[model samples]
Target: MSDTLTIALAQINPVVGDVAGNIRLIRDARARAAAAGADLVVFGELCVCGYPPEDLVLKGAFLESCEAAVHDLAEETAEGPAMLVGAPWRVAGKLHNAALLLDHGRVAATRLKHNLPNYGVFDEARVFVAGPAPGPVAFRGIRLGVMVCEDMWYPDVAETLGESGAEILVVLNGSPFEMDKPNLRLEHARARIAETGLPLVYVNQVGGQDELVFDGSSFVLDGQGRPAAGVAPWTDAVEITRWSREPDGWCCEGALAAPVSRLENVYRALVTGLRDYVVKNGFPGVVLGLSGGIDSALCAAIAVDALGPDKVWCVMMPSPYTSADSLEDAALVAGMLGTRLDTISIEPAMAVFGSMLAPVFAGREADITEENLQSRARGLTLMGISNKFGPMVLSTGNKSEMSCGYATLYGDMCGGYAVLKDVYKTTVFALSSWRNHTRPPGCLGPGGAVMPERVIAKPPSAELKPNQTDQDSLPPYDVLDAILDCLIEGEMSVPETCAHGFDEDMVRRVWRMLDRAEYKRRQAPPGVKVSSRAFGRERRYPITNAFTRLI
Candidate 1:
């Protein structure tokens, strides 16, 4: 076996369903690797049609398009180095998540994924059939084993490949971020290397698609399960590593850099997710409703930082109940950020709706139905602007409102993307404070106090009715977010949430609302998921369930 082989991994972003565009990306990346004198280039999982094509894979024409794109990619390999790229291949009338080995202007071999993850945000079992035995392909005078995304999660894939005369293992991944998931990936990879006694390279996709964000923390581990080379998170890079075969198998010879902070990594993931959602979808810019509330304020900061002031338009839709402080605070914050600000009073539309629904009210006492109408009217005005202009409307509701049915269905929830839908209310406040103290890398605003002090200090409210606060219907946000953390993220039973010094009644109340709100969450726009158990795709609850939490 030869000792000196150079491998290149291209951690690049690919938009879903953009076959021609993705092929161009692959061609460009492979050209760069060939220019650097590398033997072969590897890309992340599902590079042809992009990661988690979701239901797009179900379409026969789309899969055919992906296949056509892969063939075009295989021909390009003749001009450069061999390419190990991930895509979908149908064999025996079943679709498999596969990686193709391209050399000498053709596909030399295909490696299919074995483990299909069905938990959390993954539903691979529903889409792809599990692969069979592992095999090694001869590329550049070396036998290399290729494993797709979830295949790397299991030890059997690496062990079988290593035992079958494979010299190196390369795994392509479209793994989504979930808090400390990168650390978990490293730990799992080390264990697999220790068991297989083979050097391994892991490459992952970067950027946000819908509710999922892929953190590109691609790294190489030596035969002894030691770190070799790595690329940073939430950014695109092409990393080339030189390896040598030893008595023990293969080892890496290079100086490894320090790892970035967890805070920094997560913050970058949010930014990347935001940037991709806006750019890839072909929106001219983004428009957000700027309530002085923490959720809207945080989303405005993220939008301005992601797309800059010229692209972000902030509107203050004040109602009769709108506080002078909230209106002033919102305008003040928008001024600091330098984004285009517009105020559209909803009172006129409110009168129209009020008059229209007067017969139905029938002299009854006004309730939350009237309050929700106010929210829905505001939503319609924003949509009207979005229809006339090309800017995408960005909704500001957080995970807490999304989880407990606190948000109106077509009201505050209407938008192209829910910027903070995956972020908890508590986290919204924390990130807001963090942004005020120290801005992120590309924040487009004044130095001090992007959000007003009064905004953060005041008690939260919908302000639909006179003197109505959020606590009237729910607990304190501090208490409410914590209980939700336990119930939703922690997956705690009703009793388990109460164990955390919470009142049992409050815990039960939060849990009940969370259970009943499943339908609303299903209809929400995609948001950047920052936690393990964001309300959509991950934690599923039946909308029709009748079980009640006992007090």
Candidate 2:
């Protein structure tokens, strides 16, 4: 038997439902692998139909198309490295997520995923039926155990493979981004290696699918279950990882991927999510209201970085409460980014709205209703741009606002996508600072200090009323964000939060606001999810529930 195998990890991005495009990617990767003298090329799970196809696989025609694509990829292996391609398979009226090995112009074997994850952001069990745990596939006299994304998370599947005389393990993943998840992947992979005593090759998908962004941090683990090498995260790369069968076992000689900072990981996640959403959804560009505040400033910078400055359109819709500093700052930021900035006064529209509503509220005091009207007027203007032009409106609300019901329903919430929907206010400030300090590679916007220093140092306000700041309605951002993290992500009860040295009244008040804001979050547009507990899919609570801290 040959004592060596050169394997290539095709950590490429795939657009969902683009069967032909995905097949092209597989073929291209195979060519590259063949040129590199690799014995096999591996791709992430469901590469043919893309990961988490979500009801698209339910259509018989879609499955048939994916099957045809698999055969085409199989035919592409006429004179090159064998390919481990993942696709949808239908057997006897049942559907499965399978890994197909193609060599010599035919499929050598197929391994069905034994375990399907049904937890947060994954509903694979609902779409794909689990197959029986089985042995490994033979590749050039090598017994290789193939595992999908979720299969390797447990001990059962790897144990089955090790017991069945499997020599090596290969894991294909479409794992999404969350803080500390990459570290967790390495930890989980090492555990599987420890159980099997087999060197492992991990391949993950890259690019964004709706709210999910898969950071392709493909890597290799030696027989001792130690980190060998890794591919860069949040980008596309195809590299041949050379592995040799040693006296002890197989060892990987691959280049180590550079570690990305936590802040860069999050920033890249946001950029990729926005890019893919705009590109995949056929939106030509994006437009947002640049209120000269930190939230809008950070969002504007993200948009320019994601879609380039030319594709970004910034609108300054100032009203009666608009200040000279805001106008100057918005213009300064836009000029720095080189994106087009348009000023549209909302005064005329607000006057009309106020007059129209005054007759209905002849005896009522002007309060939040009037404030919300200003917000709604701005929302109307931004939505109008989205309708007239092709650019999708980008909402700039952060998680802290979403948590406490500080945002208006039809007002500032009007947009096609929310860039900072899951980002906390404190993180937003930090991210702004990071961007100003360093420009991420691949960003088309100008590099230095895009966000003004004054914007970062200013007291944040919605500018809906005179002398009004966010602190007037909500607590200080540092305090509010800390409490929100405890309540939303930590899932602490009011009493539990108060026990952590937080003021009891503040904890109770924050809990009530978070609980009451469920309906608003439900209506929010999808945003990039970089946290463990995002609003839309990860955390779901009943909007009509009467449960509260008062109970």
What ranges in model 1 sit over 4 Å off? 253-258, 439-449, 549-551
Every candidate's lDDT: 0.83, 0.90
Residues 201-245 of candidate 2: C-alpha lDDT, one tens digit per residue: 999999989889898989999988877878888778887788888
Name the lDDT value of residue 464 in candidate 2. Answer: 93
Clashes of 2: 0
Clashing pairs in 2: none
Superpose all Cα atoms of candidate 1 onto the true structure and report the RMSD in Å to 1 decimal.
Answer: 2.2
Give the Å shift of residue 43 in candidate 1.
Answer: 0.5
C-alpha displacement of 380 in model 1, angstroms? Answer: 1.4
Q: After superposition, how far is residue 146 of candidate 2 from its true place, in Å?
A: 0.5
Task: Give the per-residue Cα lDDT of candidate 1 at 259.
Answer: 79
